[model samples]
Target chain A: MLTKRIIPCLDVKEGRTVKGVNFENIRDAGDPVELGSFYAQQGADELVFLDITATNEKRKTLRELVSRVARHINIPFTVGGGISSVEDVVALLQNGADKISVNTSAFKSPQLINELAKEFGSQCVVLAIDTRQEADGNWYVYLNGGRVKTEADCFRWAKEGVDRGAGEILLTSMNHDGTKKGFAVDITLQLASLSVPVIASGGGGTMEHFTDVFRQGKADAALAASIFHYKEIGIPALKQYLQQQGIVVRWESNENFIC
Target chain B: MNIVIIKYNAGNVQSVLYALERMGIAATVTDDHEKIRSADKVIFPGVGEASTAMQYLRERKLDQVLKDLHRPVLGICLGMQLMCAYSEENNTACIGIFEEKVRHFSAAHADVGQPAGEEPLKVPQIGWNNIFHLKTPLFRGVHENSYIYLVHSYYAALGEHTIATAHYGLDFSAALHKENFYGVQFHPEKSAAAGAQVIRNFIELVPAI
Candidate 1:
């Protein structure tokens, strides 16, 4: 049985974690490697490091961070943000990143998805779609960190991405992102119909929300940032809660063994 | 022990190297025939299409080098599939270490008894899944039904070489063992602790005489 995945995403800038990660025991909250290993220790199935660095040296910084994370963390991790070309992906993968997520670049040039899927296997390419529901009640794809909206319908675009050989879809809803209400179950449910696995992101405020996404929305995995970084929800407790809710998750009996 | 990872045109060998480093084992990633043939244990790791990889291996005659190894050889993911006799992927012929055929996952949902309105088993079968019926020394300390991470669309059909099994719509070979060759469908490097344990077990295995 394939267990539902729980992922904690971290935003990185200049090789340092940018978000406020409120962990008391952590010595350096700014270190992406430390935070990533911390999450892996806490039973995070996987980690995603979105390199938000917008400078000329972003690639070098991200590569170094990726190498450090791979050296320390035992589980799989994906590196995204500012990944535009095959060279960028090769650099990251060579540095030990498992997968690379492409959003704006992929939307800008949909062939980028095909080229990546060809160069690396589809398993290594993750198509992240940032979408928002408009007044027309139709979800539209958003680009450039959710600021610019495109004419691409979320559902149709997702299918096109999948057809282009994207092995996984990371669907993040802009409207519900920070609202703390719940995940965008409606669009997520529709996107789950695609052949590839769908990872629902944004708007995960509670453990029940995770259950809803996996159960009702049929998401194979759910990704969140702040709720986990702030210590509001511990991964062990969340896994336990999901287990009680009859969701199958990978449970590590000896959590400290990895340490 | 002199450990060498046979490198052709595959991805994710870096993670395998890091995993070995965690166990304090320094492994050499090389396609050089001398290094691989001289190493006490050889690891064949891959993540790519079958025909293309096989073509690369054949072009360099690494296929013959791999087939000629007398010591223990371990294959991961695409490496495992390529160890089989044949693969439906691009209708490619693979090394004959394991006498099974690798078949692609079909979207047919009725066979799995998936109720209508339920999502069919996703291709690539990403995330963690348990392996059971462990038989070989490869899985010595690993617990049965221990979840291991996997991401692939094709699987080797269960046969005499199967030492472990996992289900995703049907029972398939999770791990296979022959005279001196071992192949696992999962990425032991990225599977966390239990996966690490599998790697440890492989490292500790005495090379077959």
Candidate 2:
């Protein structure tokens, strides 16, 4: 059995880490390099850094930050935000980002995914989709920091993203964002129908929520921030709970614990 | 001495670097012929479509450089596949270091139980699987039925050079070992500390020069 992944997402703005409620009301978190090391030490499977600053100059700074973090952390890290060109993707990868996530750029020009995949290989490109449910109960895609609404169906875009050579889909639920209720199971199930691996994000309150997303929602991985950042749950204990529930995890050596 | 990782559009090189650091060895990533040739050990790791990956290697002239290296070299996943004579992935030719052909797992096994004549198994066999029939140096201190992580759609069928075996729809080659060149289908770096130990074995095998 393959082990399920537990991930923590950090939104980076002006070199500082921030967590927003429903992708708004950003509060100061801490320095990304320091927080990244902390999460890696606590046994995070992967870390995601979203550069929410939305400026060209900040872009350069973000790449440097990625390089600094990669110096110490031994786990995979993903960088997103204001990425509009292939050069941007290349810069991040060269600066130590294992994977690059594209949301707004992916929607603005669909060919961006195919082009980037062709240049950097599909496994290095991640299509991050942010979706919100409409009055008709259909999930509509949102872009540009979730300020623009598109007619693209969430499921359709996911299938298309994978078809365009996206190695993985980072599906975040705007409705569930910062709610702490749970993940969007319906959306997750729909995306999973495409045969491409999907990571469920938004609305993770507790460890049980994670297990539910894995078992009921059928997500390949779960990404959360407040839960891990606020010390509400530790990764080791969470893994223990998931293991008890019959979820396979890559367990580290307790006997080999260094210091 | 910095261990040089040959970066030719391969996957998991970063993870391999992290895995090396976890074991107290620092490595530098490079595709430069001189830098890689001068390193104590070189690792070639990859994931993704094979034909395109080979194209990238050839475009950078890494194909020729890899063949001429006298240092200890380890290839993982698609890295192992590229070391073969040829690959069925997109009907691509590869470095003929190992006389093997990478072939997709036949769908014939899916119909094993069906009326005596139907493709029975699935392609792109993903997830955790067990490997056995190990050789001395790589499988050293590891059990025969030790489980390893795998996420490949195609596999190198068992041949004279196979070092280990695993069953998907049937028994297939999980690893290949030849003179000076070692390869494994499963990622030892991503396989946890046990996997990390295999890397340690490879590091220890580095001729102490």
Q: Give me the candidate number with maximum lDDT.
A: 1
Writing each residue's lDDT as its tens digit, candidate 1 over B95-122 gives 8888999998773334457766756788
The prediction achieving the highest TM-score against the true structure is: 1
Q: What is the lDDT of residue B11 in candidate 1?
A: 54
Q: Model 1, range A70-165, lDDT digits (tens) per residue? A: 888878889888888999988888898999999888988999999999989999999998898999999999876666779989999999999998
Minimal lDDT window, size 10, model 1 chain A: A20-29
What lDDT score is found at residue A230 in candidate 2?
A: 76
> Interface RMSDs of all predictions?
1.8, 4.4
* lDDT computed for candidate 1: 0.87
- TM-score to native of every candidate shown: 0.94, 0.84
Q: Which pairs of residues collide in model 1?
A: none
Off by over 4 Å in 2: A55-61, A252-259, B7-39, B55-65, B104-153, B157-175, B186-196, B206-209
